[model samples]
Structures are given as structure tokens and as C-alpha cells.
Target: MNFNKIAAITITGTVLTSTGATLAQTTYEGDEFMGYASTGEAVVVTSISGYFYGDYSEYRDFTYTIGNDYIEGTALCAGGGTKWIAEGYGEYEAQSEATLNMVRFVCEYEGELQ
Candidate 1:
């Protein structure tokens, strides 16, 4: 029947539209810092040498298949040490700027002497 065919087409179109929206990609970039702390230290760690600093950037292409409320994508860093990774969590954010937040730790290395 004509009514049945039209109903099926409508449902199909709605499904496709929603799928495309959820699969959309977003990118974010900001300064990043990488560092480690002692397990037994009770003192607050606040020194320039304590942490290696740099820029953090990433591309969130799709939702992670195995996790809840998580996304996976490529990540990059720039500054004293340059590094890249194929897959990383998209929910890392140390400080918020605009609509995106700065990644906490994408890569780690010894910073150059000033």
C-alpha cells in the first residue's frame, strides 16, 4: 500500500539524519602539561621544573566503541617535545577555553633548558 511505503521511507530518512549528526567530528587545541608526582609526597608540587609544558591538540572523529560517554581520536603536541598518538580519550581537559578545554596529558618528556 502507498501509505505503508511512505511510512517506511520517513523512518529511514529520520534514522539516517540522526546517525550523521551523532557521527560529526570536533577539534580542540590548547597548551598542555605533562608531569609526575611522588606517591608519598604530602607537599604541594608547584615549581616550573616540576612539570614539562607544551601545546595539546586533538581531533575527535568518533565515539569510542567500548566505553560509555567516551570518544577516541588522534592527538598531537608541540613545544619542547613533539609527539603524536593514533588514539586517545577525547574527554581530557585541565582548563577550559572557549568551547574546548586543554588536554591534561597527551605526551611527556624532559623540557629543554631555558
Candidate 2:
């Protein structure tokens, strides 16, 4: 991957609840990492399904989930030959089951990754 490419990602969604339908929208920016992967802000669409919208298989393809996501020790930053994370974390309603969290990762690279 070219480390010099900077991208902005956005996500939008809503939650199905008893009280009423809830809407959620979040955007994140990639923080530059001089010579490594960039950091990003959290935009959780929901607890489990919201965070990863691209494809669950994609993460499973490229990541190793340690344990319950959100738990600091349970989740490890994956990708690249080394593990790195965005500048932010995903935000979800722990007690709310009908909520959706959308998370976007903005990657700001510096050098080429080969």
C-alpha cells in the first residue's frame, strides 16, 4: 500500500428500537503517522454490526480478534506487517441493543508499504 495516500471515510445508519427509530451518523479523520499507519476517529453504528460495515469476513481475513471488541485488551490493532490503530475508538451503547454504530477509518500514510 502506498503510505502517501490519505483517505476520508464516512458512515451513516439508524437503529430499530421500541421507543422509536434512532438515527446515527459519524465521520472520522486519519491522523498522520510520520512513517506508519494513520490513526482515526471512532464512529460506531452499533455494538457488533455497526463498527464493521465493509465485511465481517474482511476483518477475519486480515485481523485476529483477541476477545470482546471494545475491551482494550480484547481488541488489538491489526493490519500491515505490524499492528496499528486509528487515533480514535468505536463508540457504542452498551445497554442499547437496538442501536447501530457506524465507524469510519481515515488512513493518512507517509511512506510506501512494501
Candidate 3:
């Protein structure tokens, strides 16, 4: 197996598999409690819009250190019909105006700032 010790054991197993994928990145390195503010209260915004749903994602520029003023609202489908215009911060988002089968992002971010 001596091809220079099998090329130094294949370069030390490719540097320990790239340092165990950078220590197994779990994404949102902020220790997600939904990043703060939004508690275990669960979510909802479906006063009638076909029971809403959610799943919006954000991390760009990454400044969500916990802003309770989680603004960016305006999605009113389920009869009132306004359906998404501003979203992305934290707490509640991902209720895509009813395509059903489930991506459920019925939305709310006002539960933060406590």
C-alpha cells in the first residue's frame, strides 16, 4: 500500500472530511429559538384566509439579532385577497397563499420584542 503511504492516507482522509463539514453546520448559527422574541406560542394569521400556512426564509445580510419590530407585513388571501407583498425577518412567514398539500406559511412576526 506504499504509494507514499497511499498518498499520505489520502491526504489525511481529505483533511478529516473537510473538518467534519465545518463542524456540521446547522445553518442559523444564532441558536434558533426562532432567533429570539417569537416564543413557543405557535403561529397563526388565518382569521379566514383558508387557514393560512407558512415557510419564508431569510438570513441575507444577517442582522436579525432580534428585532420585535419584525415589520414587513401585507398578505391577505383567503377571501380578503392581498396575498403577500412584504415578508422575511423572523417569527412567522411561509404561508404561501393556498396551494395546499402543505407549505403552510400563514405568518406573523409580532410575537417578538419581549
| Tens digit per residue, CA lDDT, model 3, 1-114 | 112211111211332232111221111112123312233232222221221122213111111222343333444434323234434633433343221101122222212222
- Model 1 C-alpha lDDT per residue in residues 1-114, reported as the tens digit of each score: 111211111211332232211221222232232232222212111111111111223222222221122234332433322222325433332222211211223233123223
lDDT winner among the candidates?
3
- Return the clash pairs for model 1, or none: none
lDDT: worst 10-residue window of model 1: 43-52
lDDT-better candidate, 1 vs 3: 3
Could you give candidate 2's per-residue lDDT for residues 20-83 as a string of tens digits? 2222223333321222112232322111211222211112111112122332211221332122
Clash totals in order: 0, 14, 17
Error of 3 at 17 (Å): 72
TM-score of each: 0.19, 0.16, 0.17
Model 1 reaches what TM-score against the true structure? Answer: 0.19
At residue 61, candidate 2 shows an lDDT of: 12
The whole-model C-alpha lDDT of candidate 1 against the native structure comes to 0.24
lDDT of 2: 0.23
lDDT of every model, 2 decimals: 0.24, 0.23, 0.25
